[model samples]
Target: MNATPLVLAVLHPRVALFELGIAAELFGLARPELGVPWYRFETLVAGEAAAQAVGSLRLTSDGDMDAIDRADLIVIPGWSTDAAPPPAELCDALQRADARGARFMSICSGAFLLGHAGLLNGRRATTHWRHCERFAALFPQVRLDPDVLYVDEGRILTAAGSAAGIDAGLHLIAQDYGSAIANRVAQRMLVTPHRDGGQRQFIPAAYPQRRSQRFDAVLAWAEAHIAEPLSVATLARRATMSERSFLRRFQDATGLTPMSWLSQLRIGRARAMLESGDAQLEAIATACGYGSPESLRAAFRREVGLSPAAYRQRFRMRNAPGAAAITPP
Candidate 1:
């Protein structure tokens, strides 16, 4: 990796100021005390000279598309609109950068711009959870992992909602420097050093949509037996109802079909085991009712957008927080 990577942030009209601030603070500021060469960051206006942003604030980029063209990494701090296509000039510049092996990153809705530039096609990416519907609908080809805090696909990286931008930035720093440097940076920023990107963006919470009557017993029973074959017929039988009635009530009660609910529960359980323990895939697969490791991988990919091993590698709990911290010999 280049020692002093040049980072350019593309700022557009009505751009998100908070997200832009994250990149600027993390990369634009000089940190000679870091004991390593840090990023050389600049802001390039995407479409206009002055951007009218939230809270009636206005911002102007110090540079232009030419700066972006010369950058080693470009950051887009979320887009203002889901419907409007990105400016032609910006798209061309991004394509040029990609061709030259320059990395691109986006915070929150900025993924929309990458989608418009045809950069996220077939790539796993994410934006804020609130706007996932619009994002997924617009770019179906982009495998939008709506649950993750961010996605790092080698050259192209993306972050989730507002604060997740910080996580994404620290992750890049860790990759370039080492975790000790990242931890020091985080200390200065007053934030956690590493919140694994694989963690769910939103926790499963009780909602008003669930059925009024408590199905605690059924849920508990299912949790204990999650490793077993969980067919709708079997679940319905346990609930003492016919399959048709069970399907209807389950949908009304949980807002998910029996099979879908089971799949989610199974994945959640498997994820817990993966994150907390070093159990082998075969054991986890059988315990999680996957029956085979191949089946487990497919399900893990579909639900989590990561294979079991990959998820464990990225998110598994450790004995020490500074495990990745670099040491000088």
Candidate 2:
């Protein structure tokens, strides 16, 4: 059996209900029969004695700042976009906890708390797309990727917005217990187990005015053949345009160049393969159009900041009780 990690969610006043719910659903739910131990989940309030969450949900905490000191994983759920900066005491507590090796994570606007706490400086992060421009301007040191669903930089992880919080929490579960357990939990919740953090946040459902149908057709084709080698010429041919024309139109439509979009798709596929844990690195590489394990490793490291083997080790499924399985490194 695997040991469960302790998870602590710190709630501020006027929290986003959905973000708080994602944390509760993933961590508060007990599933001891899956051969994984139960997570110790607690909701700790930072400021006021009691708070009203979105809807009719009222919340109170068991303790105050002291709770942050004992946490293994400290999560800050969504904070208000217009809210004042987090209190200095809260910021200090967060930094002190991080110095003690407690993993720190944030969802949506909660990322602002992390930024204020100094945990996000010099780290790549994401937040609600609407707030991204401001987030970038406010924190010049943090690299903000507005398109991704989430960014996990070792000890600190940040999610985009709203339901992206679920992806972030499930990712942490996968990291702690292995992909198999995370998948099972996701299955029980009826959610997609993995959406690569790099997926574009918004893709137009309908074509924009004056956009060419040729560009749309080429995009549909590219989505279908993600595992195939794609080049500007190949896409231009599919769209029946000159390479320069196709490049301009594609960028205007999708806000990304052909290769940039293709790389994101390939990385997303690679992440799915790593989470499944059944495929060999070479097989995953070929399936994702990387051609070889070495190529895949280089790409994975560049995009995810970790090797494919290390990713698989962190997210692969573990065998059930009584089954022979090598312990994860």
* 1-329: candidate 2 lDDT, tens digit per residue: 12556788888777677888888888888787677677888887778777687577888887778888888888888876654678899999999998988897788899988988888889999998778878887888999988788999998889888778888888988888888998999999999998643434132111222245656677778768877888999989988899998888888887777888788778777776776667888899888888788999988777776688877776666778998875431
Question: What is the lDDT for 245 in model 2?
Answer: 89
Candidate 2: Cα lDDT at 21: 84
Residue ranges of candidate 2 with Cα displaced over 4 Å: 1-3, 196-329
Give the TM-score comparing model 1 with the true structure, all chains together.
Answer: 0.67
Question: Where does the lowest 10-residue lDDT sum fall in candidate 2?
Answer: 201-210
Per-residue lDDT over 1-329 for candidate 1, one digit per residue giving the tens place of the 0 to 100 score? 67788999888787788998999888988898987888888887678888888788888767977897789999998786458888888899898999899998899888999999899999999988888889999999999988888899999999988788899999988888989998888999999986643535144321223353655567777778988988888888888988999889888878888778778877877787787788999999999899899999988877776778878887676767757743211
Candidate 1 wrongly placed segments (more than 4 Å): 196-242, 245-255, 258-329
lDDT of 1 at 30: 86
lDDT of each prediction vs. the true structure? 0.82, 0.80
Residue 14: error of model 2 in Å?
A: 0.5
